[model samples]
Target: MSYGDDSKKKRRLAVIGVSSLLLVAMVVAVTVGVGLNNDSNENVNDSSHKSTSQVSPTVKAVKAICQPTDYRKTCEENLQKAAGNTTDPKELIKIAFKVAEKHINEASKKSKLLEELSKDPRTRGALQSCKELMSMSVGELRQSLNKVTDFDLSELEKLMEDVKTWLSASITYQETCLDGFENTTTNAGKEMKKGLKVSMELSANLLGIVSGLSSAIPSMEAFSRRRLLQDDLPVLGHGDQFPTWADFGTRRLLAAHVSKIRADIVVAKDGSGDFSTIREALPHIPHKNTKPFVLYIKEGIYHEYIEFNRSMTNLVVIGDGKEKTRITGNRNFVDGINTYHTPTVGK
Candidate 1:
């Protein structure tokens, strides 16, 4: 071969060698990428498995607790979402309240929309009533939520009773909303009914849970009695050692006379006392009394309801006894008063 031909052949060989190196580098890169992708997929699967395992126990706990509820599926879903992995019954109850609150709020919004869209007079009236009822239900659920954390096991029965009463009233109000449209035949009423059904179901389920739990548990009073019998007496504080509000004269009289009276005002049903009636004496008290003012109610039934406002601080009522000095009234929810405002004696 000529010298130029030989040099051209050598150049071709060098070009082929470089092409082979490039091909090897590309193959290695693709292999490394595939290996990394497999590792990433394995890691993702492992993480998913771990998360699911962690959540399984919580789901089981929620299912067990919610099994007895009227709306078990709904209770499980809502409690699972709100409580995450917590298995505490108290926490579950709180979450149930929150879910009920949310449901009621949504129902209230829907009712308001129905009220606004309602053209027929009867439908509008019904929706208006429904809106108010839903609003009240939301308020009651919120109050229950606020008080749940403060509940002592000893008072569980009372708490459950109160919860059941409020929720039952809420359910009744929802039914009443539906009843308002019983005689009517309108799409608006149907729509409102559809919107309120979820909220009603949620409230009913909460009530069922509370009732079931209360029934299943042993009497808290019995538990308390056992505890009191077993536990030592707690050390008394300074306030417990002596009466905080006794005046010097009252304190001196306590040493001499076992039954002595000291009061800022005396109210009696008979005309023999300083005031003939509580209503008459209420006006005579100071508007913003700083010190403690005692209102001594004598032994007689006062057929009147009394309300003390926030400004009436430091005023204490000293009754002869709960049965002897009675304040009676006929105010109630049936009288078209809001349940919250139907209290015989309220602040």
Candidate 2:
């Protein structure tokens, strides 16, 4: 071969070598791209799998409110983050205050929901249940407030205002329900009245759920005034703690029957003819006392059903035991009625 041809041939061979290297680089690039795409797809799948693995914290938090515990720790933690506080109760208080405000807002929403439900017959029961649920939420919120040691007064005041507003609405709803029940005349109407009565009793009991450290809360004031009146308060039998029949009676007899124990009504099995029945005797029961007409039944079987009216706040029943003395009645649901809806086992 000539020298020129040999030089051309060498150039061509170098060109071929450069082209081969370029091809190899392109292959490696393509492989890397495919690998990256697979990895990305796997990452997406893993993320979806993780989401399916468990319930969200929001759901858990919402559920926790209905649970027996107050979830104060969770509230404290959440408030801490939101209000930007660490270590000091002031921060915790700020957080607590915010949480309480949030709860109050939620209560307003729930109250509105209830009002709407009341307008719609289909939702009445559900609305009533919602009120019960919110009552518990109110309790948890109050408990959180109780845990707070120190907080900003201005913020606390604002939050308390919200709570008071909700309480006012609740009281109105409760009283309205009681009045409706009280006015009903038919048998079914009376049964409905019983349900409302139970609800009203529960509503009254929930007043204790609030923590009124100060009179800043109006509901607190209502409860306080009501409590004061309880001293000379007539008992209406809504499940309060008191001494047993014998102890209660002995104390009364010692005080003076016609004077100190000069109650409008009294119930005792030791009296003439076993005080008739609990129902017949309820009418004779006086509303003049500062406490319930003391019904001290001696240990015996008193087969009857009993209930206290809305104004009957201090009805004290001293039973011997769940076994020894008895208030027995056989009422059940399968008889085309709610087990809770009965006329004689009435209120």
Best by TM-score: 1
Q: In candidate 1, what are the lDDT values of residues 1-347, reduced to their tens digit?
A: 99999997886575445433332333344335544654667656987555544556556556655655798788877878888877655566677788878877887788788778767666666677677667767766775666444544444555656767777877887887777665454787788777777677778887876666556435334542344452344322233443434445444544442136577889888877789788888877776776667788888988776766546766777777787888877876445443434456764
Regions more than 4 Å wrong, model 1:
1-55, 219-221, 226-347
Clashing pairs in 1: none
Tens digit per residue, CA lDDT, model 2, 1-347: 99999997886575445333332333344335544654667656987555533634333332222122134344434443454423232332334444544544454355445446354332343344334444544454454444333233323333344444444455454443333322223233233344344333323322322223223334233322333343463332224343222235444554453433443444456665346466777776565445446665545666777765534546555544567666777655334333233334443
* C-alpha RMSD of each candidate structure in angstroms: 24.2, 28.8
The whole-model C-alpha lDDT of candidate 2 against the native structure comes to: 0.43
lDDT of each candidate versus the true structure: 0.65, 0.43
lDDT (Cα, 0-100) at 102 in candidate 2: 56
TM-scores, each model vs. reference = 0.50, 0.30
Clashes of 1: 0
